[model samples]
Target: MSSPGPRRRGVSVPRPGRGWWVPAWAVLLAVVLLGPALAPGLVLSYDMVWVPDLTLRSDFLGLGSSLPRAVPSDAVVSVLDEVVAGWVLQKLVLLLPLVGGALGVVRPLRDLPLPARLVAVSLFVWNPFVAERLVMGHWPVLVGYGVLPWVLLLGRRWRVERRLPAALPVLVVAGSLSASAGVVTAVALVASVGLGSRTRAAVAVGLVAAANAPWVVSGLLHAAAGRSDPAGAAAFALSGEGSLPAPLAALSLGGIWNSEVVPHSRTGILAWVSLLVLLGLALAGGRRWWSRGRRDAATLAICWGVGLGLALLTWASPDAVAWVAAHVPGGGLLRDGSRQLALCVPLVASLAAVGTTRVLEWMEDAGAVMVAAALVVLPVLLLPDAALGVDGRLRAVDFPRDYADARAAIDEDAGPGDVLLLPLASYRQPAWNAGRKVLDPTGRYQSRDFVTSDALVVSGTVIAGEDPRVAEVARALDLPTPDERADALVRAGIGVVITDLEAPGEPPEVAGEPLLRGSRLEVSALDGARSPAPPTGWLWAMAAAWAAFVVPPVGVAAAAVVRRRRRRDTP
Candidate 1:
């Protein structure tokens, strides 16, 4: 072969095979991304709650609950609690997905030099949308966001290579853990299946359906029982803040409705800058891809178009959105259409990476380095505390000592029966948690299975499971006569009544003698004890579906490991 042509002047040469470094970069990126959470003290606020020495339950597949979203993180928390503090586990729960997200973004861009790749990864992980969601305490959704890129990557691989990537099942399982993320992945997989072979598409569809069986089955089972919240759809409609263009802000990923979660300053300017930069870079990358005829360019372009279109439809076409939400079962689950922007994040990151690499191709190595440095540093300047703790440190809140003791006492005396929480409410702002907003902890803290009237009230309407027993208990608490209250409690099958002494309003004094007393809570036993509702047929179906989805993948992974070990030993 003739001598290679002279290297082009001022063109930065690509590094030789930096694929191995992707994982290392991902780990480092995670550490940087989670810097605020890694602070010395626990950072708890907005939906993050960890009680010291509390027992964690593994009943994630139980029917009529969305708690399955936290199952993976809860498992990690349980393990991490064995060595480090529980709060550390909570931080890791947030950090791990981010690391996964970064890795997913970086893996496809391994052809680029490390610096440009890092810039792209940072751009994806440290945007205003991510910051707002983090501050809003949507960690599970964040986890899904992190897992999404990998799902797309593996899906593409399966289609192009005509063989299942070893990681597909794992990513499917991980993505399905988050309810919203699971839906997004399913949608993406369905949409992208046309790119692959028929076999590959069928396999992808099957795995996605199986992975989502838990929530899918649960949702289908309770479809008739639950109602839609139209107001919730209206409140969480996708739109920009004051004076900002909705489409531009959405593409920039900064249209969070909650002012509390958004940065006080720089939001408007940052949105404009981000939109312009991303759009310019994407256009440049599109031109490059068009010239080269790259399939990825088309794939990413489709995703971006679809994501932006959905977001716009939700923001600009409220009637269309409302119609979809009403007609489609569980479509109300996506009441926050802003979440659909998650689909655009990876595509934008990829295009940004391509644009960075293209720009670097025109510069000398040193100039490329300088530009890359600026790209990496840009996010920090625009969103200073994006990666750090949102709002403030999350100090660990302990349950009242007496509350724990009372739970113990109730466990000893009260047989198997459901506990009723008072004053009846769907949500709670506990004094112990420094008044942080959280779902009522009665079901989590009580010794026995607990029932609360707090249905998931979406936009002032009960959109999920509603127990008339919860209503009966609420009425019982309102009764002035102790005997009438006691009768009502018995009828509702509330064997044990636990009242939050600190709750606003006077505590109910039932006729029954108090069985356990504490400073924060008091428990009294009903004379005619009632048992908890038995597990429904749908629950069994859900459990079976989860088992089928989880077990086979685990077995396949194990077999693959065993085969590798066998080959290594033979060699």
Candidate 2:
């Protein structure tokens, strides 16, 4: 499996000095791209508050949140096991891939000029989506996506040298672990390596499939469990789910692309301008790059084309989205469907980076320094601090003054493992920063996310207007219907009821005690019901598995360092 030498079809191969600019350019690019994210002010704190709300509920209820019970109580319990541990762990997860990527690129870094290394690292660091993941505490998804380029780099190295045993397996595992984002990451990696021979591509595909087996198996199990509906396959080809205007609804989403200044009335000139620029670049250089000149760029274009096409198809036809969505292991839980755009953002950024790099290189070659500088400045001028920086808006979880006061009051009355019934929205806010669990966590409105086979317990399907078991649970609680069932939830040993507005019909307060009260939220405690305890067996098993998974990679890397040293000495 000898690697091919660089072709001369107007492509810039990694020559000793010529490619040095790539890394430096990449970093500068990252800084610029992330400028808005690192900017001073905050935007709307929607996601931050929301995700933690799920965590808080899970902490109290022990798999009681809307998320599937099988989602591993460890996921939520991990939030409470250590003091301020969750945030620290999340930050580390985000950094791991970038660090791993740097390690993976060591050989290439040494071989390439300093400038190229700088540019490459910079490009990776400045990627807008990557920045977003780090700031938002999307540790799992970010770590998955972050390790991707390194996997591609390793795979490419293996393809060139036939080091299949090592790199191939690593790529597979990386891809599987990143199941949701990894799908796109795998697509990008494969495309990045498309510059190699066809035989290599075949092997890579096979290896990728083998590695993704875990995710595949998980999906199968979910489907078998009736969490997914196979009937949705027909939706993929069906026409008229909505108009193009429907897909464009992302325009209404605030906080993306300095929407504050741009004003996302769907008529913002800046968005239109950005689109035109992207289109013009694609039209101007897309075909030339795709032709035989730069195979990697061509492959990237195809990957982006596929992702975008799939996104649009889903938007246009629910059937299309539903078909693919249903097949995905946890796909049914995702309602936005636009979340697929999270995949597209990086692909688009990479393409834009390539385009930027090429255009600037062309300008420099033509000695148009002033024009090139202006070209760079235009992007700088157009993009704002909010679009690129760590503004408060990006912080999804922040305790509002009123919410904080209420939580303090409640904590005085309640102990650990108590349940609360309040507006899901109130719980959605990041203010309930208690390291313990709450009842009825956020994001449970989905179908497949929560379930229990026990006749006494109801699954998410039952609660989310789907499963019949929900009605049963409602009746058992002495409530006639689902809505009343929610109101009646307090009687089921809810230690607290926190809400701004009281329910219309006064069923009278619980006999327990008033925990806390603030302007908007209220916290009440229940009198009876046993307090919850830790799952000793589950915790021990999880801790053991966690240790097993973490130890070997570290040991292997250390052993490699020693082995290389010994070999060098013997030689």
Candidate 3:
């Protein structure tokens, strides 16, 4: 028998330098197309009220004020001027991963093709939660969650390129600085490195430091506040074991993709085809990994280890529990573990992309199947509660149209700091309707999103669930009527009155200057308060901030443009 000749190992064909541009362009195109649909404030369900509730205006940016009570630290607020800046910071966090993916896809990485790179970028830049974050303004979480994947990808590149010494520390520092989300991401990145032995010790150190950094910082911050709690919140892993049904648990994973807040305008027959394609890719990737041997196994293992480890930490969340016990001194500050799952989704998406690529290589003919799966099954499997909600106070719907009209009618008649004696719950309504800052707003206790629960109502009322005053108020706010309540507003020196027109009883009697009447709201005022000067210092600060975010990136784009133009002209 003749000895078998050496078998050829399958190798990925490398492309030229110019090809890298394609991935960047493709991602940019996708983002631009999806911009209008995903960029608005429509996707945010609960945080909508909170962001604006915290909105304060200072002379700094002329952007207006911020909520004094929203942040835990005066130090953080002192450095940051506007609530909008804070909101932007949060949006940046969410966008960071997409930025990283774009970098990896477009930058001069070795041994990757334009298409392969673009797919990697799309796996994250196209994430649904990212779009939601842009609206909601969970800056710390978004920032932390978004930066990790790029760190991991960079770690992988450093190993392949023999630049571990320099890249490792950079990765560690970047990972540690992002706060809680960063810590979790750093842990995941190290876990990925450990799956392969090349930079195991360095990776291990980075992971350990990443995991512990928040606890250290949070601890110090809390200690400065002069308080500590030794016990923490119960671990969700154990506590939620029975509370969540299997279906709901699955939904939690998928529900983040679609929300009750946003309209689903893209749904059509194309959906079915997308589902099939994603499914085909997953199946194909799985088969390829199993047959490819140890190197592929190790790579997949690293990805899985990092992703799964973060998931488990979030599941257990002893750190979070302990932080809560210590009253969020250093570590417990980022109370929810669910935020870490944001990073996990992208990691899983990357795996999905890898799987799709492998399937394409193996079957060569089943690309259509992958697209179908993405369109149909994935959406079905992930999101079941796609129904849009109607506006109601009880259901937590702040009617936008009614609120806007009411606010307009009232603002025309009111001045700065003049009390608008609408229903107490009217303050809880949307800003466009409320006309002035509300004395109280409706929020949840132990909230999953915003932390204004205690402040939303006057306590005990929510626990008893039977404040007759609250019930009566809710009924009255639903309709503006001439009752004893209207007489009380004039007595209380309320300058303007805004209401929803249809009240259970007669409209409230107004004593102040009558401005105008809409179908929903009434406006009047006793006096107009002096409008304060804009905070010139704050505007300069905001100008600095806008510069901070926009200038560097624009410079890079300008350089790229010049380079491309020069290249074209050279020919």
Instruction: Choose the strongest candidate by TM-score.
Output: 1
lDDT comparing candidate 2 with the true structure: 0.40
Q: Which ten residues in a row have the lowest lDDT in candidate 3?
A: 444-453
Error of 1 at 347 (Å): 0.8
After superposition on all CA atoms, what RMSD does each candidate show versus the true structure?
4.3, 8.7, 11.5
Model 1 ranges off by over 4 Å:
1-36, 39-44, 49-59, 64-88, 191-195, 289-293, 323-328, 362-367, 393-403, 453-469, 503-517, 569-571
Q: Give lDDT tens digits, candidate 1, residues 263-342.
A: 65335566566667777777756565444335655655666677677777767877666666666666666667777677
Error of 3 at 415 (Å): 23
TM-score of 2: 0.59
Which tens-of-lDDT digit does each residue in 1-571 have in candidate 2?
A: 1112222334343344534354445444544443433332222232221222223333222223222322222343344435544434433443455555434433233433233244334434433334434443344455555556556556556655665434345444544443445465567667756645778778667555554443343333334343434333222221211121433433211122212222222234443444455454445434433432354445445555655555455446656445554555555433223323443443344334334445544443334344444444443333333233333234313334555455556556563334443332222223333221122332221111222112111221221322333333334345555345444443333444454443222332434456656654555554443333335653454344434333444554566678779999995
Order the candidates by TM-score, highest first: 1, 2, 3
CA lDDT of each candidate?
Answer: 0.65, 0.40, 0.39
RMSD of 1: 4.3
What is the C-alpha lDDT profile of model 3 across 433-500, one tens digit per residue?
A: 22322323222110111111121222222212112223433343344544444344333333345443
Listed in order, each prediction's TM-score against the native is: 0.85, 0.59, 0.47
Clashes of each: 4, 44, 56
Worst 10 residues of 2 by lDDT: 451-460
Q: Which candidate model has the greater lDDT, 2 or 3?
A: 2
Clashing pairs in 1: 42-394, 43-394, 44-394, 426-454
